[model samples]
Target: MQVSRTATKEDFNHLRIDDIKQPISESRFDALLEKLQINNLSEDEKDFFQSIVEDRMVTEEEFSTLTYEQTKKIKQFTSRSDLEGNYIADSSIGFEKLSMAPLLSAQNISDDEEYNEAIFNTFKKLNLSQDDGISMLNELGGYINQEEKIIFEDSLTDEQYDSGIRYKTYIGLDMKELVSKRLEELNQGLLETSDEDVKSDYKNMIYVYREIETQYNNIQDKNRVENEAQLEQYTRNTKPNPLYNADVVELYNNITHEYEEKEKKEFDELMDKLDISNLNNREKELFRTILEDKEISNIEMDKLSYEEMKKINQFIFKKDEKGEIIDDTLIRTNSRINALLRTTELTDDETFNQVLFNTVKSMNDIYEINNFLNPILNLISEKFTAFDEVNSINFITEDMNKVLDELIKTFDEHYQETEYDEIKEHYLSVINKYQDLKEQYNKTTIDS
Candidate 1:
């Protein structure tokens, strides 16, 4: 009879670890070990293959016991299987490790017991299945690798650093804590004055600290909240006017109250100067009616009867060659002036008078009026730029506020004299500019 011989360790010496595949059943694993002559193999080689088979068995047993919810969570982390149809994690830690099982069981790259313990605690707190937690840890490893590259290679460009920080934030990793700890280490090293190379390293750490500080501030600003009271006030007051469906009225209302007392006094003085002696009977009656009121509010002016308005119009206009009233110029000029007066809170009487005088004098035609008004409109745009810069910092200087006040007054004075469509367009533009600046100021930026 022929004697049967079993394969020895030397017979399978050519085999490598890469030759092993997954979905390895107990019988298949034993067959593989026997074929490779496990009895004759060295201690380290046998332990390595045996550990792999044990890990595979544990993974299969744990997967079988998973609830629906746990299985669903695990599916989110990994959707594929190995060549032999065994489940595999989709992260950096390969299928052989199957999640973070290897990190928990074997030694880590850095032998820091505390760091490894912290990671294990965090894994438990996440409340994920063993496989899911392992996948998460593997994903986290990618971010840590990126951070290590940045620290070790000193390749922290703006984009790279931003991406790394964002990933860490998404993973709930505390980069701030890491930075603070590193800073502490550097500070401690600075106390020792003996080694020149150590001093140089400390100096480099200082530079790195500056970059980290800037990035930290930027992140803080991006997530920072604004004052709730200020935000509420801005929202309530910035609402668009229902009548005009625009913010012009709302914005004008906001600043015009500051000039009400001064404007009322000016209006009263101007009315006193008008001579009723040169007026017709009807005009005189209307003039007396206006003067009767101690203060004519804007609402009262808007509520005036058509008869009262016509009488005032007649008194202000002149007669032409056709014996018809020439009140077009008067009407247009006053409309412009009144619109401006309604919105402005000008304290300078002389400047206010000059603006009115120039406006009335230039009213030969619409073209002449526009020519006189365009420069003032351009000035409003410039003032908007200045206001925007100040507002961005969440505070306005007295000088800038005053400049804006004067500019608004000038613009309001001339706005109504131009064609209604043209004036409305310019008014909307100014309002839109103000709104845009206000929005920019309200937004929370990383640098705030």
Candidate 2:
């Protein structure tokens, strides 16, 4: 069997899946599972599976054992039938945010201890020596308390089903904002921040972010209804045809999901290959923003368009670790905060602002199903720009001009009678600016 992306080094040494073909059915999967020798399952593992069968609550260790099995089963994403079959009788047993965590926890963090010992394991994860982790927490740890740590960890989880949308709706974003602020403050505190305890907290924040993204899937599967509804409302307004509005909205929702899936797939594949430990805070923030993009709820997506890419940029930059929007009003003093960073990312305050602007800018165009611009104006040219038939980007730029012409014509023809300045002016501004930016980009290409 090919090693599953989620497989462990331990599994790598003991197991080989060179022969487990895709589309393996239950019988086939059963035999494969048996061959792995469940009899060898640790005492904890045996109790876990039996509990799962009994529909009793097994401990976290049990959850981890089964996760290993589910992952092996889930690698069959290409085969829907095979994937579907895994969940036929016992629905909750499948891989999704629902299944992966227990397995990850068991594999990564052992469960010999229940509460305090378990929370203490966070020390190892934060990359602090176990001693340092225990010591720092041991020092001021009285402040958080054992029970408080448990609650904090539990609350931070972006788990499915149990994770209320309100978690992302407000909680997650707020946490992100808070963490970002903490990081920013730490950046300022350069000297003051170096207390070993502070460093430990910084590492802990990263762990929290990772687990949230890993399990929550960016709140994607969670927000289908609300997004579709808003799209329906938008559709109703645009067509002025109440009769077909339901159909129109449903169709539009499907398109929105599909477009989102495409970008998400690309982004996911990209991240699975990265060595995350090497990346810095800025890089991680960018990547997290990208991953978390697809996981958002429909309502958020609906509200996101007005901001353009700038919205994404601001959302991330202004965000704390938990993912909340920062106050733009903070800018007057935040400029000083930005200055303290020694990285290549936030070149200046303007560039910092641009990152936020760009994040939301490309969002809608690439993800909207009926996005007229990309479908019509979109161009694909050979990557060999030096010897290509026509420079690809240049070709795309030219195609964009044609698309722009169509935009102007559409506005002129449709709004000719309406004296709605706001509606007319808004679209006209969009067209003019889009064209100017594209042309300027191409001009730079030409000059180069």
Candidate 3:
């Protein structure tokens, strides 16, 4: 008879069971048990080892006890290099098996405490420390609670089927009542807490609860007819067609005709009240030309010729008490030029010239030229000439003409440089023509 021998650490490194070509003899089995140091083996362990030698099949229960070193030895014995070849020796699989075994077995442990104890012990066996084991158990409890919530939601009755509303009619718990209770609790908390942060947190919680409660109640009391109408709008099969309905088509045509007739009547009344008969021939023609359009835009007003604009300006701004045309455009332009003149530095001749040029070009009519531009030109001429204020400044003096001629020359020079080149050219022509006209008028008066 072969007696069993105790396994040495070096013996395990040389172990190779897969190389065995035949079933282990009784002596070899005894020797294998001795190498594994299983003298006090239980019946289950004995049967497990016996099956490995007799039938060459490893059981999960037998394999579960294997460490990484034991797995490596098994791989060597099985002519496999990968330790993972032993499925039951994998830590992940072992964790799953260990974790699930207690759960499956606890199907009979109806007591919650007992079941928890079983889970705790299973997790403990998984080599987790006490704190880690408790934390994992807490996480599992949270997951289970979430699953229970889902199940509860799915099991809601028709009366409690409002989505996102946490009210449970089946449990006779009204979310509004819960909100009221929470509000009372929050008020109490606010009174009890001296800490501002804690009070703020309680207030915020109350706000959230109140919002949820209000929304839930509002949804519960929603008008069924309106809801049904909205739902019908979303899901209705038939669409309205105004053209297909004779009454609707007739109503639309009648309304459109009525609107057109009303607009025409109003326009004709406005045209009838417009009396351009007193206007001069040129003004009448220009007014008629503008009347050709059913409407006049500000852009069209800006595009009017200088002569045409003059007639409109004279009619619009009739003579005031001082026998001067009260043209707001010229007044505003003069005010703006005066403001610029007041702000301008005397030595900044470039800026002064540019302002003068722009102001002259902005005049849209003869009225603006006389009232707005002439005054600005006079100011510029005065600025250029060395005149003693006590002496009256003659309008057609050599000094004024010299200043005017220099300004005209400057305008011509800036014509190509300015964006308003056409307007600048027009200004130069106006100044030259004005000087010529003034000289002729003065000579005529002298001759008479």
Per residue, candidate 2 scores C-alpha lDDT tens digits across 38-83 of: 2344556434344443331334454334333343223222111121
lDDT of 1 by residue, 24-68 (tens): 545554554453233444555444334444433435444334332
Best-performing candidate as measured by lDDT: 3
The residue-by-residue lDDT of candidate 3 on 119-211, one tens digit each, is: 333442454443333333332231122222233333444343332212111122222444477578777876875444345546655554454
Stretches > 4 Å off in candidate 2? 1-49, 54-99, 102-106, 109-403, 417-426, 442-447
lDDT of each: 0.37, 0.33, 0.39
Error of 1 at 156 (Å): 31
How do the candidates rank by lDDT, highest first?
Answer: 3, 1, 2
Q: In model 3, how large is the Cα lDDT of residue 122?
A: 45
Which has the greatest TM-score? 2
lDDT of 3 at 48: 45
lDDT of 3 at 393: 26
